[model samples]
Target: MTHAPSPASSDRFKSFSEFYPYYIHEHSNQICRRIHIVGSALVLVILATAIITRNAWWLLAMPVVGYGFAWVGHFVFEKNRPATFKYPLWSLMGDWRMFFETVSGKRRF
Candidate 1:
């Protein structure tokens, strides 16, 4: 079987525009994509709850909730390391883009 190149390989994505397609490729597994969507949604809900209730501690849970689901999806379902480790900003942008895409029915859930 042919193997996909590692993200660190000569796949020089010099811009978020270029990196997004690669980000989507990393999350091709259905379950992994769903987990990411749920995590992103939960992060928004948790952040909104924190603001409405004025509970700053709830703010701390955003990353925990977000990364918890995402990491499980990556390790257990996707069987790959998350690009977040190597491309934090781009990965975060990709997460939201994917979330919106899924929600808008442009991409499947």
Candidate 2:
């Protein structure tokens, strides 16, 4: 049986700029956005810890902590599937971009 294309599949983004708007839309919920920002910040902390202490094991927790918070925001608050599943690279980029934007006062937290 032929299945219809999913929304994400149907909307193919040609560039990071194009994908970013959709990414922002997906995180419209205030609480969800805050959670994502927190997750991204924690990822940075984990990376710093891994580098400063020269412990590779700390690296593993990065994804767990980042994705864990993001997933909870998406599933619980947004009630939507994460854009990460369909747009892995762009989603990751979006995460960092959003985090920075929020922290820099360009976007709301």
Candidate 3:
């Protein structure tokens, strides 16, 4: 038996600029996109707290908190796999950009 590459893995983006549109499309569902924003914001807060308190453990919880909400959104609302599995860097950039876009009022939450 042979395994097929996931669509995300099949297309290798040369730059984050190239992947962002696709990233936006993947998060088309309103609830799913909103969850991502909340998750990203929580991650930032945890990082800030970690820095202020000098507690490194909060840093460890970042990925869990961030990806936990995002994965739920993808699995339950979007019914799709997360791009992070195949495109970590681009996916991270997409998450932050999407968060900022939402905050900036460029993209509706």
Give the winner by TM-score: 1
For model 2 the local lDDT of residue 45 reads 94
Across 9-99, the per-residue lDDT of candidate 1 in tens digits comes to 5656678887887888889799999999999999999999999999999999999999999999999999999999989999999999999
What are the per-residue Cα lDDT tens digits for candidate 3 across 1-109? Answer: 5332334554687677777877888898899999999999999999999999999999999999999999999999999889999898889889999999899999999
Clashing pairs in 1: none
Worst 10 residues of 2 by lDDT: 1-10
Stretches off by above 4 angstroms in model 1 are 1-11
Expressed as tens digits, the lDDT of each residue in 1-109 for candidate 2 is 6332233555788788878888888888999999999999999999999999999999999999999999999999999899999999999999999999999999988
Relative to the true structure, candidate 1 reaches a TM of 0.90
- Candidate 2 matches the true fold with a TM-score of 0.89
TM-score for each predicted model, relative to the true structure: 0.90, 0.89, 0.88
Total clashes in model 3, counting residue pairs 3 or more apart in sequence or in different chains: 0
For residue 46, model 3's alpha carbon misses the true position, in angstroms, by 0.5
TM-score-superior candidate, 2 or 3: 2
